[model samples]
Structures are given as structure tokens and as C-alpha cells.
Target: MSEKIEPTAAIEGAAPGAALSPAAQRALEEAAARRKAATAAPAPAEKGGPSGPEPTRYGDWERKGRAVDF
Candidate 1:
């Protein structure tokens, strides 16, 4: 029986079920790990600027600013 071929040139070294060569497998695993870590969470927004107030459950009605009627 013959081995099935993979589509990716990068992973061409790895077959469907066959174990990858040590160096190739390690590189692939490391790259995968890094990608996972990078996409794990969104970067935190910077704080302490007038960009906008953080959302609050309480309405801003407490402010004394003149109301604009539609």
C-alpha cells in the first residue's frame, strides 16, 4: 500500500498518520503553539484617556449638562 499525500508544501513532510520527522514536527508544533497563544485573547485597551467613559450601568443623567430635545 502507498501513503497518502498531503496538500500543503510546508507540511508535505508530514503524512496523514505517519509521525513527522523530529525537527519538522517540533517546528510545526512550536508554530502552532505560538499561533494559539497570540490569538488566545484580545489585547487590553489603553486606559486614562478622554477617548470615552467606560460603560456604566448607571445612566449619565446625573450630569447637569443642558438636555438637547429632539
Candidate 2:
């Protein structure tokens, strides 16, 4: 099988003083926004799961690793 590439392969491909193109920058921003939006939704629970009261505040659930109420 072919061997893995070195980490510096991409750095070697670009010109010494080159900067990211506008198209490339825009693509990166779009990808980041999509990722954020996708993860912003609450996770779905299975049937007959622990259904309970809504959280009072975000920081309350977030303080614990799981978004669950104690």
C-alpha cells in the first residue's frame, strides 16, 4: 500500500508569501456556520426516555456534562 503523506506536504505546495483566496475563506466560513447550526439543536431522546420539566436556564444544564436535569 502507498505510505501516508508528510504533514508539511500542504505547506510545501503553497507559495512562501501566498494568502488564502477569497473563495477558500468563504468556503471555510460556510462550513463553520453549518456545523454550528447543526449542533445547536437539542439531542433527540428514545421512546419512553426520561421526559421531564424544561430547564430554567442554559447555564444550569450546561454546567453538567450532560444536558440533563438532576
Candidate 3:
């Protein structure tokens, strides 16, 4: 059996052209600055190989330079 779905209520301060309080504006600016700074920072260089032994196939394991099977 199908049931009727009710419409969701609108969120406060989420409408287009809505004005935000000074505190809320400051918080949004700070969050945006932090995001920009995080993205501007350089990422660490990746190592050459896997950090630990990983399963390659069913019942098989592979490490830096060796493979084991059972």
C-alpha cells in the first residue's frame, strides 16, 4: 500500500537573500578562511609502496617484497 508524504518545513535563515546576523556573518567568514587556508597548504609526499601487507587475491597476501599463500 502507498502512503501520502507530507512536505518538509522550511529552515530558518535558509531563504535566498536572507540577512544573517553580524555574529553569524563573522562565523561564516572565519569558516571560509579556514577552508581556503586548508586547501592552500601543500599535501605530504606519498611513500613508494604499501604501508603494510595487503591481501592481493583470495587466500594470498603480499608485503613490500614478498608474497604468502595458504
Candidate 1 vs candidate 2: the lDDT winner is: 1
Q: Candidate 3 — worst ten consecutive residues by lDDT sum?
A: 5-14
Superposition TM-score, candidate 1 onto the true structure? 0.39
Whole-model alpha-carbon lDDT for candidate 3: 0.57
Top candidate, metric lDDT? 3
lDDT of candidate 3 over 1-70, digit per residue (tens):
2544333233233344555555555566677678889999999866874555545645557665686565
Error of 2 at 10 (Å): 20
Off by over 4 Å in 3: 1-16, 47-70
lDDT of each: 0.56, 0.53, 0.57
Which stretches of candidate 1 lie above 4 Å from their native place?
Answer: 1-20, 49-70
Runs of candidate 2 exceeding 4 Å displacement: 1-18, 48-70
Superposed by TM-score, candidate 2 places the C-alpha of residue 62 at a distance from the truth, in angstroms, of 34
Q: How far out, in Å, is residue 31 in model 3? A: 0.5
Worst 10 residues of 1 by lDDT: 54-63
Clashing pairs in 3: none
